[model samples]
Target: MGNITGFMEHQKVPLHYRDPMERIKDWNEIATLPTEEILREQASRCMDCAVPFCQDGTQLAGMTTGCPVYNLIPEWNDLVYKGRWKEAYHRLSRTNPFPEFTGRACPAPCEGGCVATLATDSVTIKNIERAIIDKAFEEGWVQPNIPKHRTGKKVAVIGSGPAGLACASVLNQHGHQVTVYERADRIGGLLTYGIPKTKIEQYVVDRRIRLMEEEGIAFVTNTEVGKQLQMDQLHSENDAVILCIGSTRPRDLNIPGRNQKGIHFAMDYLHQNTKSLLDSNFADEEFINAEGKDVIVIGGGDTATDCVTTAVRQNCKSLVQFDIYPIRPTKRAEDNPWPQYPVIHKVDTGQEEAKHVFGNDPRAFATTAQGFTSDKYGNITGVKSVNIKTKFNEKGEKIRDIVPGTEKIWSAQLVLLAIGFSGPETGLIKQTKVALNNQSNIKVKKDTFQTDEEGIFAAGDARTGASLIVWAIQEGKEAAMECHHYLMRNVS
Candidate 1:
């Protein structure tokens, strides 16, 4: 540790968001960067713990305890404290290939496991990480790591999302020719379109994609493998095929009036907005206009929060989010002890902005949407909702029972379903004839990434269901290693 008593001397310095009124007017990132000196002070606060659980990457109580990528937290913190910005970036890049992405979007379970959090405020690890990577780019420290020699091996990475990108990056670094295929017009799968530009600027994603191209990785956009290119053709061309196709089939709300107009899936709404924003800077044709409409978002996750914030930016008349589950406790319960990821309430940036724009918080816990009411043209006009309580049956199965006489109608011109995804779409899996798990995810070996089909492997969200970017990166890296080894051994 650079400063042993640094934790005692400095309190945690939190990142400040731009004023809601000013930031909501545009799609730029709401966060303002801290100065180098202030960032150094924040990094210095990393205590020299005997056991650094911040990077332990353990699963406790079915939640991630620390960084899934196992970032060298203490080492980089010390480097930043000594003003070794380049060294700090290198240390961070050693584990996470894209710190800028994680630094911006990751929920950062690392801070929850920080030793300092036990008695005092935890280190601003995510902010410091962002500072390191952003500095590396500013100072021209980041460059292409082109391999001197080629291994004469070709690998095909399906989907250019976080997992696919990570796998392609690693395989390319190992001197193998890697080609990434994306079904969308852009390179990044979710990072490019699903996420709003307000969270991570498109240029940040573009910068990394440009670097990867410079490093000799080929990217084919608007190319769907199973449809445009046959699976057998891909198998014949590439030595190995790694499927990082993310779980993107959104969970639908199956109720009466689901087919009504003006009701859309969250991703469809978000994707259209980002695409239009980039195409013409939000001018031209409107994309899912929420202006002056009472919007109802169904779910209580990050995607749902994104919907809330996006609607606010569009100047929606009113916003309300419904969660079937109860609100979490403000503080960690006794069962969630130290080193365990706390299951407590948190107000994300979007939620905070929503509160600022609307006079109150927009979340309604233990609430379920019963059905929808429509106008003469069949466009949704209102939502029928009821508050519900959970009860355990004789077999110990939890069930939700609607409270009698609690049904109410709320005005809603637009309904966005933000419920989580079930698993990866089965089109490619069916075309390729790969086995799937009970949950519809690609089934790989217990400790390997190899699918039942030869020369095909699955990783990331496609195999593990929807998860954090860090976990997806880890899966991609591990799958790359296994794929590389298989390629080396099976050389004809």
Candidate 2:
């Protein structure tokens, strides 16, 4: 517990972010480093709730509430309040291998479940955790201490994303020889490529990768396991295989003119933009520029907000985002009480940036794209959209109905589809002949991460559908434990 009277005396003061206009001018992190004194006050706001539901990650009414990684929020908050940053960092890293990433991109369900939020503003757990880890890095305390004893059993991890990275890091700490294979030119799959530099700087990822390498985790970049390398080689080389390739195949727009140029998936646009920025500055790159063009983004998630904000930074003449579903309320509904995910609408950092620059929220609720218009050379010119209404059927499944006479056209020279993903690509699964669940996700027994193939396991988006980063980290840790047990059985 913090100061007995701290919760009453101090209010929750979170991190400060750069002004929208200033941030849109370049690719830098939005959150400004708040003073340590303010962060300490924020940490002291943690109330003496008898049952701290913040760490009890649970799914209720088809929605997740609280921290998915089950982080020790109370413990860490107390540590930060007491100025024990090293202890706070250790407790945070004990559960979440990479607090730096989650501290940046995560939605922070822990905040939602904070009992203080029910009456007063919640403690700033996310910001406090971020500060602790950053302080650890500054003090040069974050070093890779390789296991003293080697198990001599080799393991091949078939991805370098969060899940794979977490699994590899944990397994390596457990004394296994781990080789991480990444298809991309560099490590940190989504963290490096999919996530824009505006959200998370690439060097943050680079630092973690350097530590992993120093810890004896072998990272082979630009090496596609199923394509460039064979599954047969992986099977023979490693004692266990952990597949964490992620759900990469984007959900597509089957409507007319989808094949037209300038209409691309969100990840492709983000990836190309990041690569171009890394190679040179945005001014030098002509490809994927939204300058002076009408931009349209389709989807209503973090990714769509990113598209909108990115286009704003690109100085698009105008921008509009469409969500197929209706808008959410500003406050929780009567039925959705405490300990449930607050599904009410709140502006994300990107939306806030767009609002500051564009004078309004760019998202259009209850709208869906019908088709696209193209120029003679197949460059996108405009987009056709229609309003839609949603209702539940007899089977209790929600369905969308396009409203009649609501069709409209908007000039959109650039269209980005951020409709989310279906599942992982079929190339690796097809080649390996792994069994898939009905949802096209890799099938594995619950709790135990073992796939049908003995000594082979699956975790993260490949096991579950598109999910939160915290869940992926948890899955990776659990799978490593199960894999450890399976590997030990062979030795004994």
Candidate 3:
């Protein structure tokens, strides 16, 4: 520890956020930078434990407890404390290729595992990371580290999400020619579109992508591997292929009035709204406008939270979210103790904004949508719902049992289904001829990310099914290693 007494002297300080009332009026980032002095104090609080669980990415109680990318937390913390910020940036970037994205969007498992948090507050690791990277960018130290030698072999990554990008980044550093293909007009798959600009500014993603391009990684945008471009072409042209397309096939609600005009999938609604905002500022095309309308969102997760906040910004007259599971306790239960990811109920940014505006929490736990009601002209007029209980059926499959006399009706001109995804689109999977596991994910060995086809591999959501961004990045790095071995074995 640089200062042995630092942990005792300093208390944890969180980054400031804009006032809810003012921030809800626009789609801008809510987090504000802490002053330099506050950040310095926070950086000094690192206890520098012998084990350093904060930097060790491990699973306990079936949840992640530390940085999945294994960032050198103490090294960077000491560097920051010693007034060596450029070196801190270098150390931070050594393991995490994209700190800016994780700095903004990641849930910061590192903080949860902080040794300080065992008794007192955790060090502000995420904020420190953000500050280090931002300083690096401002000082022009955040440039592409282009490899000095070429490996002569070429690799094509089929998606540009965190997994695909991380794979390409590591491979490029190893002197391999890497090309990233994204079907969207812009790079950074979910980072660019699925997530809103308020949480992570699109410009940040663009900036990183630009740096990667400068490092000699080619990005081919607006090209689909199965439709616009043939899979056979990809197979023949590239030395190897890595699939990181992500689990994009959304789960849908199949019920009465499901075909109503205003009812839409959550990702579709979020993606279209983003595209509309980016394309014409909502001038040319019509959006699933929540302005002055009663909106009902189905499901309870990050995407559901995004819908609530997005609709609030759209000036929705009212909003309601349905959660089928029982409400979680405020603190970890006796059955779930320390070091486990706390499965406690907490107000997310969007729900907090909703509560501020609506005079109550918008989420209704143990509730589910029964069906949608439509107006005379077939627009969504409201949603029908009821309380439900979960039970095991004869076949051992989980079933939902609707409670009698618990039916409720809520006014809703728009209904958004945020029920998560199934797997990658079948079009590409079917055409590529890669085998799938029982869960329908790409069949790959536990540690190795290779597929049945030689010189081809898979990673990210495509390989692991629906997963967190951190896991996807880890898989990408491992897959890159497998690809490296495959290439070296064949290349002269």
C-alpha lDDT score of every prediction, in listed order? 0.91, 0.87, 0.87
Q: On residues 35-64, what C-alpha lDDT tens digit does candidate 1 reach at each position?
A: 888998998899899988898687786788
Question: Could you report the Cα RMSD, in angstroms, for every candidate shown?
Answer: 1.6, 1.5, 2.2
My TM-score estimates for the predictions, one after another, are 0.97, 0.97, 0.95
lDDT of 2 by residue, 20-114 (tens): 88999989888866798888888888887889989878888877778888899988888888999999988988888999998888888888888
Please identify model 3 stretches exceeding 4 Å from their true place. 389-404
Q: Write the per-residue lDDT of candidate 3 for residues 212-248, one digit (tens) a residue.
A: 9999999999999999988878888889999999999
Where does candidate 3 have its weakest 10-residue lDDT segment? 335-344
In angstroms, how far off is 439's CA in candidate 2? 0.4
Index of the highest-lDDT prediction: 1
> Which is the winner by lDDT between candidate 2 and candidate 3?
3
Candidate 3: Cα lDDT at 48: 73
266: Cα error in model 2, Å: 0.5
Candidate 1 yields a Cα-based lDDT of 0.91
